[model samples]
Target chain A: MADRAAVPQAPELTARRRSGLPRAASPAVVLAMLAIATLAAVVLFMTLDLRGNLGYVLPRRAVKVAAMLLVAVAVGLSTLMFQTVTANRILTPSIMGFDSLYLFIQTALVFAVGGSTLATAPVVGKFAAEVLLMVLFSGLLYRWLFTGGARSLHLMLLVGIVLGTLFRGGSSLLQRLMDPSEYIILQDLFFASFNQVDPALLWASAAVVGAIAAAAWRLRHTLDVLALGRDTAVNLGVDHRRVVSWVLLMCSVLVAVSTALVGPVTFFGLLVVSLGYQLCREYSHRWLLPIVGLLGAVALIGGQLVLEQVFGFDTALSIIIEFAGGILFLFLLLKGSLK
Target chain B: MIRLSGVCKSYGTARVVDQVSAEIPSEGVTSIIGPNGAGKSTLLSLISRLQPMDAGSVAVGGLDVAATGSRELARTMAILRQENHLTMRLKVRDLVAFGRFPHSGGRPTAEDRGHIEYALEQLDLLTLADRFVDELSGGQRQRAFIAMVLAQDTGYLLLDEPLNNLDMKHSVEMMRLLRRLADELGKTVVVVIHDINFASCYSDTILAMRGGRLLHQGTPGQIMQPEVLREVYDIDIRIEEIDGNRIGVYFA
Candidate 1:
């Protein structure tokens, strides 16, 4: 009974599928949606009237918008490539300790320089130092793991979790031992609040994000095959080690830009990428990457808009996002998407 | 043709493939038969460039697998390993179309589409083309992966335990298809097979291994004897000719 209706109507269904155009239609549509959402964010931030005149508000809002977009793309693209490399959707770069390393470096700076120096340090200098530390640590860790063999994946993940815990413990210890005033200064940098983004670091982060996006676009085809798992990708003539190295490097740079711009935002990458996967069911990266990038832009801008207008600035938007993302993470874990 | 010279692979203290050297024929299906833990799969992995060799070199169609560009090697050989895990949901047609990735680089032209359709039809998956691979039955999924290898349109194909989850009907169909691929298309297929009987019926050459060592390599008539199989498998086998095909019965 099922075959009879399905068989004869298969051609029509394929035709309908063509008209649907999943991969072709989604990126362009999501891009437009992102443009609208971003425009809304720009308008909302400009008119909110928290402090400052029109000239002050315009420049400040531009910096914040640029920071948000950079973080969105960086985190989004990093998580997407990370998931592809591991062949596991539930795990993110944050889970693998990149953010923790960031926290560690920040804490170490305060601990080493005796808190007062850190408080007086320029935001641009601090951000640059943090980015450099993360890039070096991640490159060393990922390069060693990827070049070695396959069994090291689980081992690397375990090591990353332990390292993250150690970093967190170390940071907390330093935080407790530091002077109270210095601790307050450090606290400002630790919390992931988009409202207090540093304007001085904007151009640097933009350049980084731009360079990384161009590099990722060049490796798009290799990334599509990489989704099939390392072995299959290698069999298909992709230089597995080289492509993976490039992708991991891109991920590190993106993570650095995002974390440097607006502190570390956990779970945002997961939320946007998952939505992107749902929107573009096809596995081709040519469509998937743009769709994910655009969806991330939309989520950030839209969430910001809702926070300003609907919440009346009463709550931190990251808290709300984390709550929902936390629930989705649990659902995905229990449902065993990785398995 | 695929050639392995003194290939050795080790994990910790244990050697998986130890000094194994062989030149695989340029045509016909060749089956590597060995018990679990024997270096059959590891050898296949090394030749396919999925695993780096610890000591030696593998060459495919005169290009050293180590030195050759992966894209160049990809146009020549395709491999399917067991336990394919997909984090993303991919339709059968889309999965098959990936075979053309090495050649077309993700943008499938009309020629690539034809290859994809032919592969799907070859595996009796034309009806299931649009179905998700993860949603298919084990046998169906196995066939889909094999079809992906065929769609690659390479001179050589390497498969690791391809019959792992396949049913009796599908397993026989798969062997027959591989045989046809070799016979009609002149594709050189090196498969790690579990069933000796299937190997005997379908393969032009058989390579037997034990404890990471190549124990024997020969044609079906030479390798299908009870004494040879008993020595290789450590199990008594009764070989009988049925309809001009050598069938090994091992239950007794």
Candidate 2:
């Protein structure tokens, strides 16, 4: 009742003018265009070189693009689905402490066994270990809460935030006590950068992201119902507990994979999903999910290209995105559009 | 019949609905009325399975609400709570189309379109079908939500304070529509209403609750007395028969 927009009178004319502007610009069309735009960005990134050393540059660029795309899909889809289940727009899956947990795991690994052990460990093995620990903690906790005690979603959200603070504090304390050389390794790993995605971990991240996307696709309709808020969803006969539990578990895995692949871009999901909402009118995930994924990919690929070619490695892509995304976040809060 | 057997719900030390055991007949309109905090809305929520009970069970059409699958229960009953809000920018038509989700699973069939049209027409909202739900006036939005529930076309409807936004004329019209829904469509409606005159004029049965317990459940003729009204509302209410309806005058 409070958030009603002051719609213009006689929307008929505005709709007619809009129709003229885009004869074939439905939400599906918008999503397809975004996909194409991302594809174009990828092509431009790959073949923009005047030297034209295709063999020398294409594989390396392709690997980077693939890693970015995987992380994009993971973050975008997880945050979108999490917002729907929580019935609010102000939150992302990062609130579940997965990002801080990622940091904590990295710090604990370094603190317990030292930096050389982690550096010496196979990339796949270390990635697998980090992802496995997060998945187990999140999945088991969700299962116990949803199936065993079956508490309220409000309670779960509060618990998640508190746990996030605890993890962050724990990691910070560990960071301060660590050896200076070990601290460097931890800092390098904790900072999110699209430039440093490991080639070895790319395949595993892709597989995990693919599995998550498929699961999300199957539950797309149910997810739309969930966006109606808990009471209405229950009124429409949704198995609220079961659906929320599964979605939370999936969000954990997605967040873990994305953070492990590209460190932690806390606001990338917010940027993509907000842009996705602005770009499309449809509420159905069929349009929204793809649009957000494509937008994320485009943003990362384009931002990286500009950073490389224009800035000449002056800064990390994550900083620019976080800065812009953080401003957008503040604007949305002030605009009271978070719901 | 909608039956509540020993149903209970509580928050902290206060019981909002305590061991509510009653059978609501599967015909006509039934009004549950009492002062604020009298468990009227909570009872409706329990019957609709919108809230889990701390103890006991509610059964509708002989199926236990706790045991029935959500999809199956949705086919049998629909509930509309007060204070409905949407985070999505949905037009009236799109919002009403969601009523058919339990049947069509988000892909509207031709028959679903028919139901949508019928609902829109019933709410006199056909002209405003394309308007965004958030753009409408309070009453219009209320009507749109009612139309969505009507589009579900379930055998039973449980509504909590549906008249919260309506004007005097619209309130009468809305009550008449519910009467027609019950008399013509053979649906059972349980409404938590505030105005006693509307209840007396429209409902076939009345359930008066007080202090989280059922104080009285009987036909309007049997339960609309000043004594029963005084007991339920904790105030002296004078009953006057006007236009063949037992109108309770509690304003004084």
Candidate 3:
């Protein structure tokens, strides 16, 4: 009695699954490939120039590698988690103005107390202040504006962009008025330099980043549901607002550590996570977090190696990453895949 | 059983759901019918806690939706809205597997897989279970979503306009499915439906809502009268009894 003729014959799903290569290889296999890529980058970064004193140079390079990994984990996890909570693929946690916020904080410090004291001040105090402010700024934004729905997500993004513009605009104004010598000092702080990273702050950053990564891992299941949108997630009985707040807080810490380490590198997360999503076809964050983090590590280490070895340190690595990431942004926009 | 007491919601100046209070009985197919801007969807949203209430509370099966743990509430009740847009590409089977999340927490056990398989067959989607949801037609996608909710295996199911993109055959198939869910499975099915005749034919009880308040809630036979239909829709509708089901003809 039913009209069977109207049913569009869906392609034979059984046949397709049998032949699907993406599904045929388990997510673990993909992760192994990413792991191998990371190991190759590490080996190349370590022994490419074997002439330097193994004792001094290897440890220093090892420290740089570790710093890069910390940033990679922070950026990768934060961006993916942020996209999950906001239910959009194109957005990054940096859009929350954390980058500009960091800039504003540094510029304000230099503007208030002069750059010399800041450079000489106890490293612990300055580092703690920056990290704390990042946490506070993200918490304030999440509390004041981010309310766990599509309307709120858009409004938050708009407010963040506006706030970012204001922060950067204000910093620029201060820089213009600053003494020439002090402006140079502030400029040094602004341009991300992977060439020289302070060894003292590395341990603290690892502790903090490690803690946040653990927290994110614990909530990976919740993030998977949150990505399903507010309605479906709430129906599934997820405490949407609470989970979002935790995620925002975690993102704040992650972004703070990364920005604090290497200044601010925008769009790096987008490139890494976008590639992760493409490579790893699963929705569960358990598989996604590691995949994205490892991908980020490979990108950072490989790019730095090329800049140092191939290009003779003539250019900063962030510039190349930013350019490629910018192109990816435009491509994603033109493709209209982001919703 | 779902109980709503003094439930109200407002958007800016307009009160979308105004102190709506009703006790929906368990174990039957119930359809909410109303004209546009009538607060039918808003009421459902409030009850499901998808949208917060300005001044009210909803309790499902004696558990306070506001106070209950999210996973616990999810285990008790499931609600599906009309529109679903996903940012991630997902296979139909994976999407349906998410229904077991409230139970399995993303790890699918053999039992969860059984539910997923059963839901697929129930919705006539076993053949297309491996297909991507986005690749399917609108009606097939709707069925896929329905299958996901059904796989949740909750005691109570709240659906808002589940038939939005379906043609006549699929719409009838959906209604019959819900009818079986209520009659055979003894699940409490609450649906927001636009078709008055379908509401009368498939639902054991039909609730009439207009202007953010419940106008009437009764058996299909009681709500099928021309006077009640006019009060709810603001239009004259002639009703006829066919095969022991009330059918409303609104055509001139």
Taken over the whole model, the C-alpha lDDT of each candidate is 0.83, 0.85, 0.87
Summarize candidate 2's per-residue lDDT along B17-68 as a digit string, tens digits: 9889999998799999988999998899889888889999999988899999
Worst ten in a row by lDDT for model 2 chain B: B243-252
Which residues of candidate 1, in runs, are more than 4 Å off?
A1-31, A48-52, A113-126, A146-148, A151-158, A177-181
Model 3 iRMSD vs. native: 1.0
Chain A TM-score for model 2, please?
A: 0.85
Tens digit of per-residue lDDT, candidate 1, span A213-278: 887888788788888888888888888788887787778778877876667777878888887787
Model 3 ranges with Cα > 4 A deviation: A1-25, A143-145, A152-158, A177-180
Summing lDDT over every window of 10 consecutive residues in candidate 1 chain B, give the lowest-scoring window.
B82-91
Worst 10 residues of 1 chain A by lDDT: A146-155
- In order of appearance, the predictions have TM-scores of 0.91, 0.92, 0.93
Ordered by DockQ, highest first, the candidates read: 1, 2, 3
Tell how far residue B248 is off in model 1, in angstroms. 1.1
Candidate 2: how many backbone clashes? 0
Docking class of 2: medium
Q: Judged by lDDT against the true structure, how good is candidate 3?
A: 0.87
